[model samples]
Target: MKWTYTIQTEGLTVEQLLRDEWRLSKKQVHELRMAKGILDADETPIRWNEPLAAGTPVVIQLADTVSPHVPEPNPDVSIVFEDDHLLIACKPKGMPTHPNDPGQSGTLLNGVLGYVHAHGGTYAEHVHRLDQGTSGLVLFAKHPVVKNALDRMLEDRQITREYLAEVEGNIQKNGGTITAPIGRDRHHPTRRHISPSGQPAITHYSVTARRKGTTELRLTLDTGRTHQIRVHLASIGHPITGDELYGGAADSAGTYKLHAFRMTFIHPFTGKKLTAQN
Candidate 1:
């Protein structure tokens, strides 16, 4: 795969672009250098250590890698946003983001692979995941370099993910932040709870609506942990409706009400601000 990028700042070296700006791994940099993958607009080889002027176009080339997931085409899957480097798809509630075992079909990743393969592409990977019971937008990387950049972005909290959920009780406070450590629940195989020794987790929420039996909430995460939103809300005595694992009431459809309604992030390759809503 080949992509072109123009230098936005003056006097930027190839080393700085790879190491500091794109944050490419040492192995990735070595591979590119070995392949002579970075070239000028005229297809001439560019020196890695030399500085280049602003508006200079650079072409990047990388070998295409095969996708690991099995492609079982399903038209039900929806692709919301897509570019040469990334894709964002809507995931329905009750579907796993990826398969737990090899050769598994019907998971979101498999469906995505079908779409990618059909479109003459060979690679697709999810950058982040939502629980099987949560419905929302899931971001996917079309290539390995973009995947690494996105992973770093996620660790730095540069990507924003917002969720809407209905909880079991009315929250008296209009808005609040949950700053608690989250650890695994020993008794349950797939549950998390607050613990002093656990990793730091933060959730921000505001009450959107309050009815007689439940409250609707808009939540954003500063730290992404396993079941962070559910655990934090339940810790505050307002577990999400239908999140039975967290001690909340069940819903008519027997699934959680949490939805990842919005996501915003700067495009790793194009440097464009991208937002997707469900």
Candidate 2:
């Protein structure tokens, strides 16, 4: 489709015309140039070096066809809790919070934006994070005060997080604590491992049920670290079932059986204790 606009300036160069009259930015102009979308006032494709008179009428002929390689992303989200100052949601496993790679576009943020747009659009922000493969209750704030308060609580260990997981071995005791330091795996870029020289991490585990071959445990994190449950459990010889990273079964489809079961925190705005269990 060709859109025509009258040139107000009589003899400015085509570059100058685009510079002043284009609604999009200069970078957009360069992108349009790359797309071969820029044209002359005479409806001809103009060279980059071409100059134009100020008053020349410009015609920008855009193609009707859409680019096949570029896919349009739709925004979406699932709301777990909502109030004047915060919105909480359960992030599904295997979806990213934000776009990291070209393959990841439609994300939790996109969905939240769509939700905001639908509900009269309030000021909202994500306060914390969960890995792409972890599913859990995550909080978002409508006010910076709420966010800052939650950050303080998290820092102070006031927020309690409990998780459930099925691991490969039979956890001998009913409950035990793993006081290991966690650090990035030196050999693997995509995983975290326990090391003597890493940051302090405390993971408390209580055996919930014992399957003949596998043991299910409730893991409460004393200090949240990257892959703390999987790493700590594996450090003690019980890698999470299906967690292929720190060594678990790849044969079963139900591997890496970790679930965020409960979260406890005082309401940032109301000053009341609030708990969400999933």
Candidate 3:
């Protein structure tokens, strides 16, 4: 893959520009230098410490490496958004985000790979993940530069994630916040619970609708803990209606009532506000 950038500030060496303005890590710079990936507008090689005049265009070409996994095509996979820099998809319930164990198939990652492959592309790097039981919008980067930019944005909390869940029982309050600590369940290896010796978590919820023996909620999280939403809701005596593992009713569909409804963030390359939904 290749990307080009126009030099906006003059007198800065390539190393300085990449490190300070582009916010590239030292390791990435080293890789580019070692691979002879930097080039001037005229396709001439450029050194890491080489200084360029203003209006100079720089090109970076990444190394091509073979992939160990090949994803099979699935007609069910839905592509919600795409561009030269990013690809967004809406994953259905029951599909794992990626393969956690060897020989695993039918994951969202596989589906994305197949989609990209169908378009004569070779790579797809996911920026974040959603659990298997949750259905929602997922983002994938087309190149290492785009992936790096997204990772930084997520670390700085520039991406906003929202969800809709159906919980058991009626919530008395119209809306409220749940501030608690979440940690691994002592007894269940695959479960999470509220504990004193856990990471800080905050969940904001508002009642959206109510039905007999069930309530709909709009939830937002301040921290992205492993089962944070499920644990927090269960702690308040309102486990998700179909979350059998979390002490809610069994679901015949083999899925939960949780859905990743919306995501709001700034496009790293275009500087445009993007709002994606299922």
For every model shown, the clashing-pair count is 0, 12, 0
Compared with the true structure, the alpha-carbon lDDT of candidate 3 equals 0.83
Q: List residue ranges in candidate 3 displaced over 4 A.
A: 6-17, 20-22, 46-56
For each candidate, the alpha-carbon lDDT, in order, equals 0.92, 0.69, 0.83
Per-model TM against the reference: 0.98, 0.68, 0.88
- Give lDDT tens digits, candidate 3, residues 37-78: 888877777877877887788887787543345676978788
Error of 1 at 40 (Å): 1.0
For residues 220-266, write the lDDT of model 1, one tens digit per residue: 99999999999999999999999999999778889989999999988
Residue range with the least summed lDDT across 10 consecutive positions in model 1: 68-77
lDDT of 2 by residue, 25-131 (tens): 46656755776666766666777556666456666554432211113224335677787557877777776665555544466655665565566544455666676
Off by over 4 Å in 1: none
Which candidate leads the pack in TM-score? 1
Quote model 1's TM-score: 0.98
Task: Find the 10 residues in a row with the least total lDDT in model 3.
Answer: 63-72
How far out, in Å, is residue 138 in model 3? 1.4
